[model samples]
Target: MPIAATPLRVLQVTDLHLKTQPGSRVWGVDVDAGLSAVLARIRERHPVVDFILVTGDLVGDEPDAYERVRQALEPLGAPVHCLPGNHDFPAALGQRLRDGLVRWQRHVIVGNWQFVLLDSSFPGTPSGHLAPSELGLLDTALAMHPELHAMVCLHHNPIPTDTPWLDTMTVGNGEALFAVLDRYPQVRAVVWGHIHAEFSARRGDIHLLATPATCVQFKPGTAEPQVDELPPGYRWFELHPDGRLETGVERVEPARMPASARRAPT
Candidate 1:
């Protein structure tokens, strides 16, 4: 196979959950400060990324909270694309985004890559599911972009999380999801949020990645609900001109008042 050539850089953020009121805390952490802190980290590391992908759960359903989150991202210097999570407000999202904002099941093609962002929010549930409309949309988009390697981003994990607790509420029609994905060999990766924990695995050629929350990460495989104290983080994907993607997570402490880490000797 001949190697394709065009570089693409993508930064993914998940589970910001910023509250509408400033200074409000989500899961014991000040969300407003957390949003700022995470953005600071992104700017420091990815000054000029090709694009930013917000995986979902931006504001914990406050509707107004998205303003704060969007404002924080304003200076990131790239096109910001988002998807909805189980905790996100679909109505608010629709209102806030521009008329041209890519709809729930649109195909965004850049260079040799096509990113398909899906909405997995179940109307009245903490968990998620892919409605028939969404599945059909995804099917059409993948078919149209068959020439480009794809990255599917959604709020829910379409694969088992193994934490029996979470596994129960994961994407309800995942097998159906995988069934569709199986038809598209050009899909190189599947990235999601919602789990809040950090995980990476592979099913055949498609790599799967889960990012840590902007405020917190859930403990992996725990029988009980738990939040990890590690600071918020993001992931960077460098898509080679030849269709191969090099990726890894970039984590930084949420900005601190006096700076938490011990300083070097003066």
Candidate 2:
């Protein structure tokens, strides 16, 4: 197999919690303003991105927000992949995003890497689970792409965050998900969003990453929904053809704020 000529850089932005209009607040943070700033920072910091993975919580249960999401994100000029979060209106989101700018894709193969997007969301709840079909899809995708390094993306954290309250909302079938992944050595990483903070763990060679939300971040290791002082942020991953990975989290600095918090038309 030919090695990729260049490393693949992916941007992961999550827990947008967008409202139907701009300047709306979630946990006291302007999410619309937050997302826009994160995107602008992404553009300025990393001019070239291979693909973007939004790990759920795209909206605050508003289907109307998906259109605004498309508009806010389209300027990045890269293929965007979305997964549903517990707060999303899945049906309306699918209908509204059927056209162009942003998209909902499950599996993608790029630059010797297989990117698998999972739907761990369960309607009307904050917990997550993988239906039998989704598990099968993962198995099949890995079987088909044994030649490519695999990175799994989903909405819920699959491992314990050591905080009792947040751990209750972890993927209900995380053990099952890991069972499938353990069978495939090509799987290198699993990433997600929802806890609204940064977390990293490792099991041998596999990396487990939980990114901070684009809006208000939760106080890490807290027992409840306490917002933290961390600025709005996004995660970047550089996947080398040799299966080595480099990633980091970046937040829009208050000094170099990308956009004003003033209301913009949704």
Candidate 3:
């Protein structure tokens, strides 16, 4: 009998919020330091991933920081595919992250799995919206590769996170996105970032996942935005050839910080 194929290992790091200046703090946590710690853990725990997906928020509203974002991710030694979050400048990402291991790739096929990265960012606002063209891309990719299992990724949550403040920023036309996905049975999962907290749910047979930010986490189920004391982290996945997937979140202890750097909920 023939042996089964080895599962493909993939890493996802999102919501870096890196600024032009190093050591900047987001919500009292050092964003750069947090990302470095998460990357170190990734190197130790997932040293040989097939690729890395940075869902969005690579920089903190600073277009010039794309280069810094590129520098931070280069040492990982895997093809890094990135999409824009509300805080990102799309043009800058395309121009600065064009070469090397980092790229602005929308669709990727590996083994029997096809990854579709979408830009849910709407201009001049933090809320998410999928344009007609983006939906078209998904339709086209799924139609062309019916045999390949699909995992759709975006920076914004497609479902209500139950956090009232955060829900205002969820994908505005998420229903349309689901309507498209409903047509394809091969879509195994839909994953995203921007919530800064880990979320897991099931939509029929499809898996819905939201990963924590590498910088800081927001407390879930709160009326207002509140910071969670949970340490920074990333998500990992093992995609088997038969459409079976094993995934989990790994949080790392952030470097010790001065008391002044820690923020308290208002």
Candidate 2 has what TM-score?
0.93
lDDT per residue as tens, model 1, 7-122:
68888888888777888666566666766777888888778787888888887768887777667776776788888887777877877754432223345778778888888888
**Judged by lDDT relative to the true structure, which candidate is superior, 1 or 3?**
3
Q: Could you say which candidate leads in lDDT?
A: 3
Best by TM-score: 3
Query: How should the candidates be ordered by lDDT, best one leading?
Result: 3, 2, 1
Q: lDDT for each of the candidates?
A: 0.76, 0.84, 0.89
Clashes of each: 2, 0, 0
- Give me the displacement of residue 261 in model 2, in angstroms: 19
Worst 10 residues of 2 by lDDT: 257-266
What TM-score against the true fold does each predicted structure earn?
0.90, 0.93, 0.95
Question: Candidate 1: where are CA atoms >4 Å away?
Answer: 1-6, 99-105, 254-266
The regions of model 3 sitting more than 4 angstroms off are 1-4, 255-266
lDDT of 3 by residue, 116-196 (tens): 999999899899999999999999999998988899999999999899989889999999999999999999999999999
Q: Which model is ahead, 2 or 3, in terms of TM-score?
A: 3
Flag the better candidate by TM-score, 1 or 3: 3
